[model samples]
Target: MSNTPSQSQLHNLAQDIKQWGAELGFDSIGICGVDLRAHEPLLQSWLDAGFHGQMEYMARHGLMRARPGELLPGTLRVISARINYMPEDARCATTLEDPTLGYISRYALGRDYHKVVRKKLKLLAERLQQALPELKLNYRPFVDSAPILERPLAEQAGLGWIGKHTLLLNQQQGSLFFIGELLIDLPLPMDAPANPECGKCTACIKACPTGAIVAPYQLDARRCISYLTIEHAGPIPPELRSAIGNRIYGCDDCQLICPWNRYAPVTQESDFSPRQQLLQPELLELFSWSESEFLKVTEGSPIRRIGFERWQRNLAVALGNAPYQPRIIEALEQRQAVSSELVKEHVDWALEQQKLKKDQEQVENRQKARLIRWIKKALPFHA
Candidate 1:
């Protein structure tokens, strides 16, 4: 039922795919050949170094994550796509600076992108088949769900360069987007990789609270705040708690400090707009949420993946780092009995931090009293 096409016809079909992708709401799309053998060793090295942290899934997938053809049989080309997720109403910097407000990553402020991007990718694949029915096209869409090295695939497809912080960065769009891909049978003409433009920039590295970016293009997820808040289910490590600040979901200091993001546009997709409760939410308010409240608010959002226990654990740490307030102490102490052991430990830690703050304030007051007494005694004759 299929006929051979000349090189020109195949090239034209490739062009049509991009148009269809745009119409279906993708910000950009590009195609590339399936050889990703080069990134396999880099992945293995990260695993060997145990940089993936508690994410056993990364170790389980291994190098198949880099091999698109092996994962999706008969795949000759990969159509990589990017969708901006920066919500317009998100005050990323404003929220980060306020110790009382939780700074959820801008990407997670909106609806979960896995569902959004995957649906669009599937539609793109369907349209490609409809347009070129004679070829009996077959394809599979992926949105960070499968064992796929999405960043590398996007880079090879000319979507963007992998930045020093280990994220795909478009020269024009910065690094505030989600990437999805469609592996297909068509031998599409390939696009060249984008030019790396992060010249001498160490902002992302220096901005990381936990120093997770050990080197350019290297990320130790173990120390990454985003990973601790979202991926790791057990208690967050004690050493990193204070550095976490008000980030209850994911951290965005790296992206916020990057100068290239100066022109990062607000996402055109309405689905990415921030939800009411998530926008600059107060730490105490979020902490007060019952499991039902948490589930209802984060229903279609990515934060629900962490569940209530980890959510409480993250909030407890944030409260510990918050400018010491009596109410924050009361709130943290009241939850100990009602919480899981993981949450209780973090709650106890927050109480200790509050107690230390009380001690520090007392010492400062005593010193101030002595200074005042000395000043009065010395200047008594003048007065």
Candidate 2:
């Protein structure tokens, strides 16, 4: 326990690490050497094209996002782990099919994964240090907190291939999971990256509501609903509002359409379970939440970080996209009176949208009535 371990010992330690990770609730774990030079250009090109949108942190780090060694000096390997997060009560289809219901992404339905994943990885690191006292066990745990390219790291660690949607996809478990990494100073047995299997299928790209997946393995975060709803702090772009549908938080349309996700397993961790308040919530019900109520309802959930203003802003867009309902219009008008300037702008847009929907419906109804009368007159009596 006191002496530096040999290669055989390191391999044994790697096995123990995966065992510990599984015990700590990670669905799967893999280890790989940290050499991301191949992934740098792709990351650079995405940044150069401004595909990351308002997530300035992604560019601020420069290439440090690709180089794991830069984040933790002496980091020789990335211990990648994925925790299944598809909650048992996930009603993705039901929520997505109804425009009247505000669909929060399934991942955000549970407690904030940043806290849960980071805590678990930290514990796993402590166990590694305790088990190998002589091996300078310098390590850092990262949930989505670091600038690291976690998906590629996970892919390199034999976790899964990055699907067209840009999410890591396991052949067995699909993409309904959270990825975390521990940068460690160990020569652990390396795991080979999973083979790409998407072959000719463009389901994710075709299914994107906003065409965010500009190409295979490429994404434009500017058009991504997840980025629009969570990362961007300003007004939601008017062009993309209706396409946003009733997705008030994040969009799962890409994943929902991916073929692999049909086999995704429900998470075992109860922390990843949905809160009754988050799932299948009505657009009007959420639009009416006072800032205090928003905070209280979203406490301990990932949705809280977006704050009440974005919460209202997103809900306003969804309300506008909903069927022409009088209550939705009234709620938008009432909130406009007291909302922040930002929220008021979205409310105005929503009000305009509701009016348009109403106008269109009235015209269509009149046309239908006329068509029915003409059909009756032209058909029955003499013919």
Candidate 3:
């Protein structure tokens, strides 16, 4: 328990941390030294391209994200942990196929992962401190809350490899999981990084509805549906609205298409399960919720962070993409009457979409009727 522990002690502690992590419901855990200099240039390049879009925080931290030791003085190792978040019976394909239904990302269907993963990491850190009673442990837990480059740290820690879609993918568990870190001063023995296994696979790239995946292992966040729906604040771009489809929240298309996800296991944690209402919600039903109702339904969920205005804005786009229905037109008209400028803009767009479909249907109906009349007159013997 000395501040300057022996190599044997550090090695033993690393094993104990993994065991404790498993007991704490983590799917996997690994440790790595704070030498991410290899990744600093890549991070700088990503920011330079403005691929991060309006996420100024990503650029604000600069290279500090790749330097964990600098962010937290004396940080020697990063304890990266993974937790599976795929809910059982998510019915992703069914929901996505039904344009009338709102397809929220499976991760947000349950309680906010930031709260769940951070709490577990804090407990794990406490256990580490308790085990090393004499060693005053300086540590901090992060779950998508900081400027730290978590995926790179996770990969370096041997948890998984960064897949073509830019998410960490375990050969066995895929990418439907959350990664959290405990930056500590403990000199834990590090694990070897996982080998990349995404060879000859362009499934994720081809499957992206918005062409966000510009190349293998590269992403243009400006065109990513997840960024538009969750991160970006302004209007959903006019060009991408039709492609947005019915996904009202973060998208899972790339993950869903990855072959590795076939091995992704369903989560056992009840906290990760989808709420009954959100499991297969209709777009019209979601669009009809008042701001208070929206707040009440999404309370304690990750969806709450986007607030009601963007929530409605997203729904309006989905509704516009849905098939022509009088009820949908009525809902858009009603919402347009009292919504804010942002929501109103999307609502008006939805109205135009509905009107176009309505006109086309009417034209087709008239053509069909004329054809029927002509057939009846031409075949009088049958008549």
Best by TM-score: 3
lDDT of 2 by residue, 1-383 (tens): 23657889988999999999999999999998888899889889889999989889989997998899999998889999999998888988899899999999999998999999999999999999889766667899999998899999999999999988889999999998999999987778898889988889999999999999999988999999999999999998899998999999999999989999999999999998899988989888888778899999889999999999899999999988889998988888898889999989999999999999999999999999998888889986743
lDDT (Cα, 0-100) at 127 in candidate 1: 86
Worst 10 residues of 1 by lDDT: 1-10
Backbone steric clashes in candidate 1, count: 0
- Where does candidate 3 have its weakest 10-residue lDDT segment? 1-10
Candidate 3 C-alpha lDDT tens digits along 1-383: 25677999888888999999999999999998888899889899999999999999999999999888877898989999999999989999999999999999999999999999999999999998899888788999999998788999999999899999999999999999999999998778889999999999999999999999999989999999999999999998999999999999989999999999999999987899999889899999898898899999999999999999999999999999999999999999988779999999999999999999999999999999998888889997775
Per-residue lDDT over 1-383 for candidate 1, one digit per residue giving the tens place of the 0 to 100 score? 25756789889988898999899888899998888889988999999999999999999989989888888788888999998888777777788889999989889988999999999999998887777767787689999889988888899888889889999888888889999999998887999988888999899999899999999999999999999999998889999999998899888888888887887888899889899899989999999999999999999999999999999999999999998799999998789889999999999999999889988988999999998889889998753
My TM-score estimates for the predictions, one after another, are 0.96, 0.96, 0.97
Give the root-mean-square deviation of each candidate in angstroms.
1.6, 2.0, 1.4
Give Cα-based local distance difference scores for all models.
Answer: 0.90, 0.91, 0.94
The C-alpha local distance difference test score for the whole of candidate 1 amounts to 0.90
Q: Model 3 TM-score?
A: 0.97
Candidate scoring better on lDDT of 1 and 3? 3
Show where candidate 1 strays beyond 4 Å: 1-4, 373-383
